[model samples]
Target: MGAEQIRRWESGALAHAVSDPFGQGPLPWLRGSENYFDDTGQVVPWYADPALARSTDGGTRTADDVHRQIKGFISTGAAAPGEAVDFHITVDPPQQFSVDIYRIGHYGGDGAAQITTSPRLSGIVQPPPLTADRTVSCHHWWQSWRLQIPSYWSIGAYVAVLTTVDGYRSHIPFTVRDDQSADLLLVLPDITWQAYNLYPEDGRTGASLYHAWDEQGCLLGEEDAAVTVSFDRPYAGAGLPLHVGHAYDFIRWAERYGYDIAYADTRDLHAGRVDPARYRGLVFPGHDEYWSVPMRRTVERARDGGTSLVFLSANTMYWQVSLSPSPSGVPDRLLTCRKRRGPGKPALWREIDRPEQQLLGIQYAGRVLDPHPLVVRNAEHWLWEATGAGEGDELDGLVAGEADRYFPRTPLPEHESRILLAHSPYPDSEGVKRHQETSVYRAPSGAIVFSSGTFAWSPALDRPGHVDPRIQRATANLLDRICKRD
Candidate 1:
């Protein structure tokens, strides 16, 4: 009758050769939509829980749930040397989906091995039009993967794809395994702080306002318009980890450019939780100040094992968290071994509980209120040096705000740390002669770290050309370097 809707645009289409064998077509939707896209530039949407099931309605996945999901996926089936598996999906509209890929810690606390599985997609996604609309029938593929065991991974699992728009979703999971594989792991808890319950205004008046996990969490997308809120609860991830701020933007940014989000939370690294030996590399996003002993051990182990650690946050391993679980749900307390501050100018992480500051080459010091963006003391540095990213190295421009400042250690990030960019805060044009420690450093073990004294910096995934391309780019590069390592 009519053309295969997918050929509407690329009419000079080829024969329905039973297979996109050539990867051809105007494709179904506007974009050359596919069930999977882990290509160099496509961003793999990370999830707070990659094991989310389609059985629940936006089911709440806790750290335990995520941990189980991880373990389950890894010790699964094995793929042939050069063989790969794929699935097909169908969706409706007004819905967007996210597929997360991650590895489960294979052992107990402190010495876990990264259990690799097939790279099967997680999260909700759209089904093929052929299946959804009954247009043709079902979407064809090789296999639908599931963990064959719980502690013996022979391949890698990847959240192949996730797509949602309107109210429809298409999700697919797949796998690829070889002698060498770079499976995703929950490396650290560098808080994304992207979600919060904005309602019950009174209850959350001073409850540490975090970034909304999504621009669309409520029926009424905007935060203000939403009636109730969903805070204090375990607000999971979007199958995508962000560097510092808004994740979706970075998701889009990574889609446009290139970056891989290797993330983890305190819960994922706790006592019977994640093992650190599984991964060949590790990553710490910006403002990953809140960490637990387990999380710390994981990163440190990765570094000690010669696995590169990319520390892309202004402050790294400053605080520690504990996984206090609850059957009623995850409202576990997040205690800062270091001092914790609240709503105020220069929100500082007091030194009340910090014994690890020395390790990061920084100690909790002072606070700065809504300060103004001032010139970094060394704008001519390499991060901004036109030749390199000196001036804007770690921070492209001035931090400009009353941020809680810290009395940083002289040889920050460590003598073994390679410094990248540096900047300071100021009052007037003369630039208050104080330095606010904004620099990028790499440890001797090839562990790269970046720091910004404040905690409001978000990556530029969505805002690529924003003022601080350095924050995002530097972070991306650091992660890339880690990912590229052996």
Candidate 2:
């Protein structure tokens, strides 16, 4: 096994190594390398061991660089349906490796097109260590995995392995036959079920001006808001750590943006319920703070299989969930809770509580960005133009709206710049200003996104502030970007 999707070896190739705003930078000096991509679109450098390798974009990519470019497993041949395939491996043992496999859509496919996955693909116990020459010393033994390959409905996904231990890194890749089983994976809860679909059962609170739903999305409520009109109708509630009017605003904005969406029932997926791929992307809408291992694994496989992701969320990959069935088949009847043992270690299992900033360029401070609306001054910032809005030159008018001052996320990172979309602060007066602020991330995956904080643009559309022409055009532009193919 080797470092695969989202995993980065410490390939020392950055222009510089900067400290994190909150956490410590990775230990072990990053190694050096010259970029030379293999046939599979994977970049292979001379060094197998790298202490500073990072995902080209804002993700955790090892030397393998699986996040930006999925590496290939086979050479000298292609895979076809119903064929017998052999997956060969050369490892630097002492460093263990394991992989979760998936087969995605065709090369020219749009979004996540994967169709096959080794849902239960066995992983490695150790990966090989790196040698001095920057080459992963191939273990003397030949390890192989067999699958009755499926067509993948497209081309095969190069087997993606996460290095469980440390080892000498290598450029050698592995392959799987086409006849194997792969599921066009769709992640849990958010995959099919939106927060609106969530109904609170403990006689939940009323839908106040603060939120559309009385409760968060993960709860199995009785008043599911699913629609029969279209997937673009209403996506889900605002992400989490609820802000005033956030959920309604998010849905309203989603409808305006024309974001096609759905979610898997918190109760359903927890009951050991799984589905093949349904939606192409498993978006973490907004403010999602909790997580489940099964839920996370499904998403991991989905991404590896080539599903495009829009983690329009903050404070993600944080909690764990379990399936507690009431012996009923209803989605709502299923019981879901934040891992009781707390965080990652479930009552029944040990799970991953991955750091959010590593996966998403921006980190959630457990504190909001600004208590008051602030003017965005990063005029030359690239994100302002990510949705083609160009730079936010209109900040003068926005700031002129009698806004309070703004706050910063301590020391922000330079590699991933941050831009303000909207903000709010406790006014000097009794007036509590609520403005939706959003930011955009032009991810390394080429996914153009708008992370709106003042999500009310959608809900506000029909109201006075909602009718801001600047808001309308800007939001519409972002929606179009989201729905557009390629």
Candidate 3:
């Protein structure tokens, strides 16, 4: 088969495997590509509306006429164990419903096994009144159920399985985290997910940062785009909860290997709830394109304090955002940002004199529609230690998506060594071919930061797929030394 044909097959197989949360068998394509790689990374598809059927477009629903007779969302998007959380429900036709909570994580060969289950709480769903935004309000729905998280609950991602009598179901996602420390911190980009959630409430076009409303209904531009998105609504699509394609891949892989890790939302960094000094390293996985002032400052401080970082995805920290409290006074429930509207607004953090290149050792180069070659440079670097990679060796299919490039900015970070590990070329938005770089550097604070500079990094860890063993070993190498440090 031709190269293009091979990539298409591989991409389809990977997508198929990841879209299933109940853990199906591996896709038959590219079998034995890696003898050592395991295929336990399948995740349940997280939909914005679990009641809606998945549309062919991937991000939208298949049946627009389908109305959810019963649906609800959690009072909070995240909470700690022993904390009582309320699940507000709205049942159409006045029916009975029940909820079962499950903690999502890797359990052996299957992806995302329901590690824990809570006692089902039954209730009657009532109609909810529309809010000022024309969306459903939890207030009128006096029919709500509560669940006190068990102290034994692990720190990670969770989903509440909401089922109505006679077999209708939906899911509500939340994070279970606390003020603990670990060898590594995995920050989930929940903000990015909420920003893109076009939950079709009130029958207008789906509302999200990328869309706006019109006289005819919802349109696909920023003209009527919501500058502020609330976490109060349910996510649309297969509910492949956000970051499943991006960050969750790494989480699954890391768990398979038993990495010493802790999970938290990126908001924790912005709110100063995370102590970076407690961990040897912080990992930003796939499409981490937004940041707040305090979040950036905290990481910079952590770097100076000897904590390392790894950016396993591209186009990171490209925009700046501000967080506000929800009606409940829960901090970070509302994320605010006005993109492409100019200065005085929350412009790209780079426009505010803080380019991400200064921190990432690379800049947002652009994205790729076609595949690119990941050419190894200076393979002698310790990162290429075990898998036997060499200078100028091309690792196929490793830089096929969004990519970054090395561009030293003013006020450069104090680094002892900066090395380009891989150079991948692809066409930019203008159709002009350009190369992206993956780099590693060490700061004077004894902190080392590695940038994969491509969105393909995490996917390279899955198997019977497009994974490269060399890349996996290289990743393990970085984690080993970083975690071993004092």
Candidate 4:
């Protein structure tokens, strides 16, 4: 079948299969209807469904089954190794569980390596209950555990695996970062993950920044939707947000190819802690939509200072979001934005007289939901060096999902050269046909910025045998030169 036919089939199957975080075919439905919060403020949904557990079977089944029901998240999604972080958990039956922390990297192709294990702790578990509106809030819970990250932990994506005596497992992912510099800095879009996460375990409240469904099953406007999503909640579906596909895929590829990569959360950019000058290249991976003013300025300054940027993402730096402290006063823990709110609320970066195109050399053209072929425009460009992709050659499915197009509002930065690389056309979510552009530009500072202009680009690397190898070779070409540059 053609790429378009395959995309139509895959998108449909993924819609139902997307919400399973554990790679399980489907999620277990909560048996309870009435759920009330305990004095500690934890939402308990399992309380109403007492018979949901098959305890009568006893032995291994009961022990093993209880662990599968455990779900939880950290108070702050990202923290330093020396800092202490709180973990909130929900369990069917309160029991002692061990926490195993693993740093996710290109570790021998496994992508994760166990770092440390915590002593078994006796604790009570809180289950999310249905709200008065019958919608679920899994984050309404008390602190279940706290761990002071050891000073020896490496900076990267870390998953705290909760395990019971019966070997049931679940994961809460976080990042550990430091001030030390490296060759390449990978900024994971954790904000985007939490923004789209609605913990759609029962398929009831999978609302996000762009979309939401009301109690009556009616879709609500962005302003009326959940304006603020907390990082204290677990992510919806596979726990790997749509953005993660590209972010992790890039990380795995870079590591396997021997790139000296460091890790940081996007919030680090907002807080002014990330020193872009320390790295030759900065990578922004997948669905990086929301941005704080400081974050934009930091990157803008870095670009001017010769830090090459690789935005393997789409619709990035699109919305302007503000950050506030959580109830715990942890900075950048809650992301707040009203995409459809009035002008008095918050405006997009464009409304504030700054467009992302000014830096990215491209603008948000439109979205492409159906799969389409990426048509190479400049095969002679250095990026297409070894891909064997000729001018006008079609690369199937690399341009699927949201995309950006070359639309420089102002004259190019002095001495900068922008090259249009690919042009792909497709119908969007509304069936309106549109086109997106992929480009690369050289800045005056000798720094180069390349944008794949599609959210699907990164994740496309993970598909075995089906994805085009040209994309991989093109990525390696960018990283090899950028990271090795003076």
Candidate 5:
């Protein structure tokens, strides 16, 4: 279909005029509800029924069942409006399947809005992945179904729900980006997600940058992990990347407040498609540990140019990686991280004389063996305003998972001012005492850099049973100040 025609179809204008095999129609909130649209007659902010989350049936039963049933990956991690994206799907037992597209956002706490649904299409089991040089890549030469993104679709993170005839399902996440400017840009850690993805984790063939199965069916550590990983495969298990929910949690909270924000993948940063300076602030919302030279350079340059930076989780920008093309000659399809220092090889950014603390204001210390309370420090700071938190006040279980801390001896950035927001003590895996310190600083360019210094921070914003009003307010305070929205 033509671009304009697709745009009209997606906007629900052509829904009444033509028969839509894809089931494109008015949104649930718009049916018999005129108030949902703005004065311009456009849908007001695009919300979904909260009941949709409870009713969605697109989850895989188990890891092994992922590939055995139905699983897929998009041809690209991010696409712009009017671009055609191909879906590479595989279904065993040769059945029929359909794809339900959803734009992930707040959506009235439903967390997603259904964009469209494809008709039943034939499904076939694709070829097995190729294992070479310790990399398992599914350069699946399977027939692909292409979907042209409608020009009117809002730019955001999206997922394609793949469901088979007999009730098997999986998900594929991608981003739709644009060149428009906004108050803040949320960068999805897709590179880190792919780094940890051990697709087809069936004990024998699955491999990631962190772990892989040995000949005796035992999991190997990083020393034996795959040196190269491919994006030509689906995510392991239910097709969702680990720690991706952290990004989603922040999204739900930020969108709930009606914050002006845009979205992009990490790859977009590396390719220079996204000029971080165009936005007032750049927010990295999850476990963004892996970094390529170009990615690091771009972000650092942006920060030096007076653009604010926010890291909501710890252990960011630790490992150095390199991106290359796939066997089919697609750029950046293969990610290689040697994790070892050599004359000319990839290694930890710290070992290369550039510590993460220089950019993040804190560096990763160690993993948190158990949950610990985050003790308030510098309570009078602007970030803690309206949070009702005082000196020594503790937020229970706010410091857990991985954590970061300020190192006086490490190379640090030259800043106009700096503050330690939280200083909480926790035990490492070896029972050694360690302290996690949340930090923030103002660079010479007047750009503010804030790091939560704990993996649990984002979860505290929107995750059920973990959300704390104090944290929610503090986060809002930070974003408002950086984006100048307050």
Candidate 6:
């Protein structure tokens, strides 16, 4: 059926002809007051309706029971307006299920808007994944359902909620991108998400780039991990990628302030479909750890072309990976990373003499076992203006997860000026004291590159109970400068 049939819009109102799993009732169309002009004078819909934030029913499944309930993945990481995307799903015990699509944004602090709902479709237990060369690929080859993206949908991050008749639910996230240019471009880290996915997780068939199951049904370390991974399988738990929340946090915060931003998948960059130089700034809002040659080249070229770049998390552009077609010849569907150089080649950017610090102004330090205070430095800088933060002021629990730091011995980017914003010390896994630094620098092209150096930065901007006004204001100052809104 067409999008109109599945979307089920009637008389300009959302038609809830299907069952309401969310119990949210009929959602209203975009109102006049909810529409605002972006920085580019384009009409953008504001999604701040408080009702949109109502929580969904059914708790997410833990790792142990992840696939026991229901799970699925999209044919592509993203799709454009009027494009057709396929959904491959598997429901244990063979039952009925429905798919509810929601656009993620700053919906009145509710964080999402129900775009549409699918009529219940029959579900079944798809066959197990095919394992070849240590790679577990679910060619799923199951009966598929197609969803055509409505032409009127806005460009942003979206998630499809899958619910069975018995109340079990899971999520499948994808981006809706367009050809229009905006002041800022937000790139989702889907490649890294696939890199860490250990689908099936049944202790007998799953394998990602990091770990795998041994012959005795025990988890193996990186040494025995898969050298390649496919996007054809669902995410292991709750069907959500690890570190995805960081991107969602940034989206809610940025759209809440009405910034002119567009969205794209990281693979979009790899294939050269989206040009970074077209926008004023490129924002990587999560733990984007993997990189391909084309992806790195494009961003580097954009930075030198005067387009600003922002890295909100640490350990970005760390691994060197390449994309190949799936066994069935689907282009760029398989990711390969040996993690070891072959014949004088290298698997990491640093090993090849082109370290990430030369571009980010900082490099990955180590993992943080516990959250620590983010000690402030250079409070007088424009990025920290109006935050009321001064030298040595510590933002509690602001420096957690993986972090990045400046290395004086490594190659640094050429810039007109450089400043260290935060210099905090924390104990590493070995009890050794190490320092983390947040930095910004102005390149010769007049482009500004800012790295938060901590995974906590994005969460602090929007996550409930984690939001800090100092961080919110400081981030606004930086984006305002980049988008020229200031």
Q: Model 5: what TM-score?
A: 0.87
Ranking by TM-score: 5, 6, 3, 4, 1, 2
lDDT (tens digit, per residue) of candidate 3 on 286-342: 668878889999999999899999999888888898888777676777777878764
Candidate 4, residues 1-486, lDDT tens digits: the string is: 222122211321144232221111211211122233333343332212223121223211211111325667787756787998788866556677777776655766465567877888765656553332322344568887888988987778777766555434455678888877788999988877677655543323545564544544444545555777666565553343544545656766677777788888888888888999999989996668888889889998888899999998778898888888766676776777767665574457766668778878787776665567888998998899989999999888767666788764543444368788998777777888788889788889989888888766776564333346888888888888897742
RMSD each, Å: 15.7, 23.7, 7.8, 9.5, 11.2, 10.6
Model 3 deviation from the true structure expressed as Cα RMSD, one decimal place: 7.8
On the 0 to 100 scale, the lDDT of residue 335 in model 5 is: 91
TM agreement with the true structure for every prediction: 0.45, 0.36, 0.81, 0.80, 0.87, 0.87
- Which digits, one per residue and each the tens of the lDDT, describe model 1 over residues 367-450? 333343433445553344332444433433334321223353333334364442444544433435554554445556665444
Would you list the C-alpha lDDT of every candidate in the order shown?
0.33, 0.31, 0.67, 0.66, 0.79, 0.79
Candidate 1's C-alpha runs over 4 A off are: 1-199, 202-244, 258-263, 271-281, 313-319, 328-356, 363-414, 428-434, 442-444, 452-458, 464-477, 483-486
Better of 2 and 4 by lDDT: 4
Model 5 segments more than 4 A misplaced: 1-67, 341-343
lDDT of 6 at 301: 92
Candidate 2 on 165-228: residue-level lDDT in tens?
3322222112222222222221223322222221111112111111212233122222232111
Clashing pairs in 6: 47-107, 48-107, 48-108, 53-110
